[model samples]
Target chain A: MSETTIGGIAGRMPKFIRRADPAVVTAFACIVLLLFLGSLYSRSFLSPEYLLQQLKVASFLGVIATGMMLVILLGQIDLSVPWSVAVGAMMAAAAAAYGPVGAALAIPFGICCGIMIGIVNGIGVAYLRIPSMIVTLATNAVAQGLMVVYTGGFSPQDSATGAMRYLATGFAIPGVPNAVIIWAVIGAAMVFVLTRTGFGRSVYGIGNRERAAYLSGIDTRRVVMIAFAVSGGLSAFGGVLLAGYASKAAQSMGDAYLLPSIAAVVLGGTSILGGRGSYLGTVAGVILITLLQSILSVMQMPEAGRQIIYGVVIVAMLLLYGRAPASR
Target chain B: MKDWRYWLAEQRGTLLALAIFIVMFAIYTANHPAGFTANVVQTASNKGVLLAFVAMAQTLVVITAGIDLSVGMIFTLTNCLASWLVIGTGLETAFGVVAVLGTGLLCGAINGAIVIYGRLQPIVATIATGAVYFGIALLLRPFPGGSVNEDLADALTGRLFGVVPASLVALFAVVLIVWVPFSRSVLGRAAYAAGSSETAAYMSGVPIRRGKFAAYALAGLLAAIGGLFLTFFTYTGDAAYASGNAYTLFSIAAVVLGGVSLFGGKGSAIGAIFGALAFRTIGDLLFVFDFDPLWQPLFQGVILLIAVSLGAFALFRVRNRLEWFL
Candidate 1:
């Protein structure tokens, strides 16, 4: 009884609530919780039609997050996803106005833009000795300026080009969306690269310890640059599909993807400090976020509420991830 | 040239910017008489004051090798709260101001706690909080509308004596209060040491966690003060406030320009204030010169690139000089 006094009780309490490993547990719990919530609120949510539609929406984000995951795995970030996507879409639409060949050119052109920015980012962080965060932040500003200049604040249209319209708006599996198929293909390709390539190991190695990796004779700068290039090209691809989805490219369409892509990568249990995540995890994370977003939007929560909840959920997930024991 | 390191060590960017400022001012005066009048001076001074405070807030956190993306959010939150709290409380208007500052402190402290205790990286933690803070502001005033009490706004925004704005007095007071604590105290010294090297500082027996928390809290307070004064300029709270966005980028630019290393440590509050003023002056000069609106963003981006390049060049020169000495 004497030992159970206030001071004694306080001294015995643990610093934080003990948590299970977030890698598998948190991901599993979120998926189940989301499914339960969605089913409880709207039975239609579980319907095949609704589920497929959700998959379709998640696919575009999933594809983008796949690239984002690769970049994050290298322990760096790209903030220009939204603008890059917007530019890709607008350029694609504008190219299609020329012909099918022109539309095809937009894809490479967009990828080239991504590669250029990636190279710049890599070089600045590597040789020029600038932080990736600062470099990317500046690039975002530059891209936004370019967008404003090229579009003059107007949304570009594919109204004159049937090819562009068909590319973006056309359906692929009767009721299933084309975006989902493209997303699956990209995700599969990323899995292959991550598992098989020497560059992939170099990326993880650099993220884990740059000095060690450099001393080990890996061209750390080159690997980082390639990571950025891959991220850039993938984001551009997403942008192309986004153009297809919207049927027209808008000035700020790319802005919305920035937070979600990052969130998806982290929530999938990838460490923010880098070198510890997978595309599969990112896919699951993308699905989680996309679903959460749809449910909230459908419930007609105020924009403010949705944003607040989004922030809270993301932070909560990260906290959980931090507390959970590492499985490996 | 071999001694360039010695020159750069003294922060050449600040000196160069000052020279540029003077040249621009001389040109402006040559073009228009009365451009240096009290009214014009006060207007420009007031704008610079707001940016200076925001930059100071940014500088404090960045010194800790962290960033508070939520600073802008805190500014908007304080503004929204001011509009709501000032209108109907029995508390004196002064207390209302205190409450707003307190709110900012609390917001920043929460961010600090999450960053430290939650073990989240500074960037991701703040990004989330930024969203939450902005969301809360929007929730409070779903639409872009709310008025500050007219009397309070007047006293804060109006002139104190002979065309010197009341805002300037408040601004100077902030500088005094913050500068002393930041430069003269043991805690201040510890902060610098900690920022320079976290591991070394920890080994030297500095309270690393406490120092970080204090830096973030101070940043929050400064952001709040900036927001409060901003209310006088706008006379109302708008949910779609652009103040936060302007402060976010401008604060970083100012810090970098003032010779604050982005990797943390080696910066001065006074220098940051000057950097903020320089940035404001550049924008104002363009307005005075009547540059095209369409050209402004492109021009600004180009200017920022040049500024960054110059900063890097100066750093490089300094490094080369150091090698020569060795």
Candidate 2:
């Protein structure tokens, strides 16, 4: 009976299906499915303009997920994304209100704030030996509190600068969005770092076995710290882009991205436990999620239902690929 | 070294949590205008017990080296369920209560099934399950207008003999009925064994899967109990997303504060309960001192950071650098 069950399944499927990264397969399948479903729902849904818009929207999540993927690859997590994103957006908007020098510094300032938070997160995890979950969570709370105090229990007053708006909304190359271009640049850099750089190898090595990596002379602490810092900076950059898109940063703007970022990374097939995954998969995963969200919204699904679907997809993907033999 | 010293070392987290709660509560009451009156104590217990119960739920899963992010959503779902069902005649109310708790159990069982049989990571599984639970809760009370059994709510949220809070009594009974037996049972030992080292537990023939399932299921039940209390206090149910998320986050903070190792296999619900109480007191401390409510999150974050830092100090004692990863 068992033989028939196994053989039946194997006989009916292409051999490549069994070996392909489950994340990539699932992501591509979901994208195709969503597109078909979307086209059926509305004829305009499959248009080049609409699809490009979707890609543009996905670029925000993709940028954030790149950083999240790196941290997850190291088997560490950064819960501080919500506030880091907020801090980045808030500081950028606040600085932009100061004029040219402030505008020039706005992006760097927001990224720097994120890097600073990441360093704090790194110190706690790498030096103090605190769990990344708790440390990042606490830092997130601190960042939230600081922002709240800064905003004084009201919406931030500063608006996005012209540069910020242009970056988020403008078309630099004909018919292509700047956000997509930015995402592509970031994605290319991540691919290089992951596939070529020693730092990338160190991230995977540490994720697979931190102790083993350390014994093998990898500076595990430094890798963890840098990875966290990059994750922080990237999340912040995503927030800046979002603020630019919205024309202003608002309180709790980053709150919505936290789970979606994780979902994108995990869906892309990076193991939540770390040390296994690919940027290509994450890229696909981000696009898939963005498409899913767009389709769901177009169908007039409620926010609650969308959230449920998002969660279910993550769990489903985990069951598909998260159960592979333990690396340790 | 003596056996008691070893015992003390094992329970240092719980003891520290207990001490922190006492000190913080004392300071809170000392500065309050009510001056530690029964009313003040009762009010505190009523508020603290909600978090205490949720923290206890978190403790069960954390003890097994896993986490249940769905705990708060379960709490919210049950609260919503109870508001709709836990009303009318006494017998009817009893049945409604059972159904609500049963739903919680079922939700938890689903979480367990997915994590164990489906072979997903606990965090991701719970996150997914949590969203589902929250979605159901939103469906149940989209506009947040349902009444529970008012008499039951008042009785439970009110004082016992005009001194001890009835909620405190309920919390104590739950500890005795749910926590004590579970902590002492064979499955409980299996859970601990599994958490401390799953491979070792499997080799030793421990019922790791069953133990973990129990932990997850029981965590859901405990969270539901917390939900029932929330209904009792508010006399209604509201599917407030922020509140649900806060409970989930706070439960983790409480567990850590109670000295339960996030790494798993070491700590107790009792410790977590105390941690929850102390964490609640930190907010009260701000209120009494006339600090702006805006500062509460910052203060809570700072305190949590300092408290968790206390646990990290032990790592500095390790000689080998690789041990840091562990």
RMSD of each: 7.4, 4.1
For model 1, which pairs clash?
A82-A254, A168-A244, B5-B318
- The DockQ-derived docking category for candidate 1 is acceptable
Most DockQ-accurate candidate? 2
Query: What range of 10 consecutive residues in model 2 chain B has the weakest lDDT sum?
Result: B304-313
Candidate 2 Cα outliers beyond 4 Å, as residue runs: A1-20, A326-328, B1-3
lDDT of 2 by residue, A1-328 (tens): 1132111233455755544566678788888988998898899988999999999999999989888899999888888898999999999999998879999899999989999999999989888889888888889888988898889889899998888888889999999999999999999999888877888888888989899999999989998999999999999999999999999999989988888888888887788888878888899889988998888898899977887787787777677766656423
Model 2, C-alpha of A201: deviation from truth (Å): 1.1
TM-score attained by chain A of model 1 = 0.87
lDDT (CA) per prediction: 0.74, 0.88
| For model 1 chain A, the run of ten residues with the poorest summed lDDT | A1-10
